[model samples]
Target: MKILLVGAGLSGAVIGRDLAEAGHDITIVDSRPHIGGNCYTERDPETGVLVHVYGPHIFHTDDEEVWDYVNRYQTFRPYKNRVKTTSQGAVYSLPVNLHTINQFYGKTLRPAEAREFLEEQADSSIADPQTFEEQALRFVGPDLYAAFFKGYTEKQWGCSPTELPASILKRLPVRFNYDDNYFFHRFQGMPETGYTEMIAAILDHPAIEVRLDTRFSAEQGAGYDHVFYSGPLDGYFDYRLGRLGYRTLDFERFTDQGDYQGCAVMNYGDRDVPYTRITEHKHFAPWESHEGTVCYREYSRAAGPDDIPYYPIRLVAEKALLADYVALAEETAGVTFVGRLGTYRYLDMDVTIREALDAAAAFRASAAAGDAMPAFVKSPL
Candidate 1:
């Protein structure tokens, strides 16, 4: 069978490799002249330090299988993500840990006392929170919410917290104890080489041919036995329905001597600050030493047609738009939509890989049994 994959990111690359190993002829196409998608990294010409071109993506997952699978491509170094936030004029540890609570309120309360204190601080009126603002106020109270989350959330989403869903804040941790690990995932590390090398290895199969700077069209997919799409879901249907809302990022890059932020990521929670966060690329690869460091000040804005969509803003209107696309996808034949953009959801690298693997396995099983291919292995909506 000849398979055509759109978007040579992790999802496309993984599925391509899997099908190719099964003796299927695979052709992968990506609009970008790159392999890793947003996870792409390259060495800085000036300092020779590895930089995440799009933004910082720390490979962290609880799935042992995922960790083992990625390790096959490159050696991974142990790296823990420790993030700090600047609110007003002071710096505080992120995820609202014990130190943050103490320093912010000017009190040395213990873990139990702090937890109780926060409960008291929280707005009891918001019993069943629906919006982001209500959730934040209910969880951390007005003062902390105003300082840390209110402005940052506004900048990141380009909307007031009241317009956003409560689920947005659910992922964030508000620990009473001093555990400041950003993610609770079991496996967390950075690839020793870079994400691009790992993706290159995945698409390095003899049966697979990768076409960079090429766009996959419906016309081009006719010759193939099956097509696996990892591009935008709305793009597949030619936007017959309205465009799904997405938050895109604009990165401001600059060179600096010595350390800039002294950390991998620094969040600017103050509303006065234009950008959401600043990422120090050198800190991401602590294994390598460079006198000069490069940093990116990230600004989030509404995604336009030409901009690269980073986060899917699944607000009420966008969800309705996505539903129409899903309906169209269901009616369509001979194609499977997989990955973040294809599914029209914000997916982490690990989840995207896992879903792609699942899709491949399901495809193989269907083919072996002489069954028709599933329209979607997992529902995007």
Candidate 2:
């Protein structure tokens, strides 16, 4: 079977490799002259540091299979994400750990005391939280919420915490003990060589032909046996139904001698600050040493048609728009929408790869049984 994959990101590349290995002729196309999508990385000409072109993407997952699968391409160094946030003119550890609580409140409370203190801090009236603000208040109270989440959330989503759903904040972990690890995933590391090289290796199969700078069109994909789209879900239908809301970022790159923020990522949790966070690229791969460091101050704003959509703003209005796209996708045939943009959801690199693998396997199974492949592996809506 001849398979055409749209968007040569992790999702497209993984699916392309899987299908190619299974004796299917695969052709992968990406509008950008690169693979790996947002996880694209390249060496800085000036500093000799591997910079995350799109943004910093630390490969962390609990799935051993996913880790092993990626390790086949490049060696992954042990790098745990330790994020710092600047709130109210002070730096605090992220995930609201014990150290953060103690420092922020000027208390030397033990683990038990800290947990109990936070419980007291939580708003008792709001038993059932509705919005992001309510969720944060219910968990960490007004002070912590205002300090850490309010400004950052407002800036990142271009909306108030009251407007955003509570589900967005639910993933963020709050610990009693001082465990500053941003993610609780078992496998957490960065690719020793960088993400691009890993993706390049995945597409280095004989049966797979990757065409960067090539954009796959629905009319063009008609000849293929099946189409796996990883581009914007709205783009598939040419935005006939209104465009799904997305938050795109603008990176302001600058160089500094030695270290910049003393960490890889530093969130500016203040309304006054224009940017959401500053990422030091060199710190991501601590294995490498450089005299100078390059960093990007990320500013999040409404995703225009021209801008690269980073995070999908799944507010009430956008959810309705997404529902229309999902319905349109179901009506359309011979196309399977996968990955972040295809599903119009914010997905991590590991989840994207896992979903792509699953999508490919499902496609093969359906094809062999002469059954129709569903419009989505996971629904966008």
Candidate 3:
């Protein structure tokens, strides 16, 4: 079977690799000149530091199979994301742990004391929290929420925390202990050789043909037995209904002589601050030593037509538009939408790979059983 994969990102690459390995001919196309999509990383010419071209991407997953799968392509260096935030002229550990609580209040409180203190600070009047601001106030109190989350959330999402969903705050954990690890995933690491190399290795299989700088069209799908569209869902139909809302990032890059910030990611939680975070790319790959450092000051704003879509703002209005596109995709034949943009969801790197693997496996099984391939193996809605 000849398979057409439109997008050289993780989703298309992983799916293409799987189908190719199953003896199916695969051709992966991307509009960009590079293959790794937003996960692209390359070495800085002057600094000798490997820069995350897009931004910092830490590979962390509890799935052992996914861990092993990526490890096959590149070396996985043990990495833990310990984030910091600067709010109101003070720096604090992120995820609002015991240290952050103690520092913010200027008191040395134990885990139990900190927990009890937060409980007292929490507003007991609100029975059920609906918005992000309410959820934060319910969990961490006004002071903590104001200092750490309120300003940052406003800048990141381009709206007030009250307008955002409470579900967004649910993903952010408030801890009683001093542990500052941003993510709780069992396996946390970065590809030693960088994400681009890892993904390039995945697409290196013999049966797969990668076409960089190629813009694949819907009419091209007629030539292949199956078409995996990993581009933006609305993009397939050329945004016939409406363009989905997304927050795109603008990276203001700069170079420093020595270690900058002494950390990988330092988030600015002050509303006065223009950018959201500053990412020192060298700190991401700690195993390698570099004299100079490269950093990016990240600014988030509404995604435009020409900009690359980063985070999907799947608010009520956007979801309504997404439903229309999903219906169109389901009714359309010989096409299966996959990945973050295609599905219009905020998916982690691991989840993207896992779904692609599953999607490919389903295709192989269906082909053998003479069953029709699904419009989507995993539901976006």
Candidate 4:
């Protein structure tokens, strides 16, 4: 079987490698000059620091299979994400932990006392919180929401918290204890070599052929037995119905001597601050020593056609547009949609890899059984 895998990101590379290993010929195409998609990383020419070009992607997953799968490609260095946020005039820990709560209030309260205090702070009026603002008010109350979340949320999403869905805030944790590790996943680490090298290894199989700077069209699916597109769903259809909403990131690059911010990521929670966060690239790979440091001030905005789409702003309007695309995808043959952009969801790295592995396995099983593969291994809608 000849397979046409588009986008050459983790999804495409993983699926292509799996299919190729199964004795199928795989041709992976990517519009970009490099692979790894958003997770692309390279050593800075000047600073010699491993830079995550798009942004800092800390690989954290509870799934042992996904953890083991990535480890096969590259050696992973144990990395824990401890984020810091500056609100008003003071700095605090992230995920609204016990220390953060104490620091914000300028009081040293015990766990039980802090929990009771937050219950008092919480807006009991919002019984059934529907929006992000309502969720924040219900969980952390007005003061913490205003100081920590409100300004930052507005800047990050470019919308009032009331306009966003409650599900967005649900992902974040509000710990009553002092666990400041950003993610609670069992396995948290980063590739010692850059992501590009890891992905290159994944696509290094004998049966797999990679074509860089190649744009794949939907009409070109005739030459292959199956097509797996990991690009934007709207892009695959050329935006016939309408463009889905997405948030694109803009990074202002600057180099400095020694440590810039003394941390990997620092979130500027005040709305007055123009940029959302400043990520020191050197801090990402602390095991490597460098005299000069590279950093990026991140700015988030609505994605234009030419801009690279990062976060899918799956609000009401975008969801409707995505629904139409999902329907169109289902109707299309010899094509399967995979990855974050294909499904139009904000997926973490682990979820993306897990889904790609499943998609590849399903394709192989279906092909062996002489059955038609579904357009989606996991439903977008």
Tens digits of lDDT, candidate 3, 261-313: 99999999999999999999999999989989999999999999999999999
Q: Can you write out model 2's per-residue Cα lDDT over 1-381, one digit (the tens) per residue?
A: 999999988999999999999999999889998888988999999999899999899888988999999999999999999999999989999989999999999999999999899989999899899999999999999999999999999999888899988999999999989899999999999999999999999999999998889876789878999999999999988889888888899999999899988999999999999999999999999999999999999999998999999998888788888888898899999999999999988889889989999999999899899999999988776
Q: What is the TM-score of each candidate against the true structure?
A: 0.99, 0.99, 0.99, 0.99
Clashing pairs in 4: none
Model 2 global lDDT (CA atoms, 0 to 1) = 0.92
Report every candidate's CA lDDT.
0.92, 0.92, 0.93, 0.94
Over 1-381, each residue of candidate 4 has an lDDT whose tens digit, in order, gives 999999888999999999998999999999999999999999899989999999999999999999999999999999999999988999899989999999889899999999999999999999999999999999999999999899999999999999999998999999989999999999999899889999999999999999999988988899999999999998999999989989999999999999989899999999999999999998888899999999999999999999999999988888888888999999998999999999998889999999999999999899989999998999988
Tell me how candidate 4 scores on lDDT. 0.94
The residue-by-residue lDDT of candidate 1 on 161-216, one tens digit each, is: 99999998998999888898888899999998899998998988899999999977
**What does the lDDT read for residue 77 in candidate 2?**
96
Model 4 misplacement above 4 A: none
Distance from true location, Cα of 336 in model 4, Å = 0.2
TM-score of 2: 0.99
Worst 10 residues of 3 by lDDT: 371-380
Given candidate 1, what's the lDDT at residue 75?
91
Off by over 4 Å in 1: none
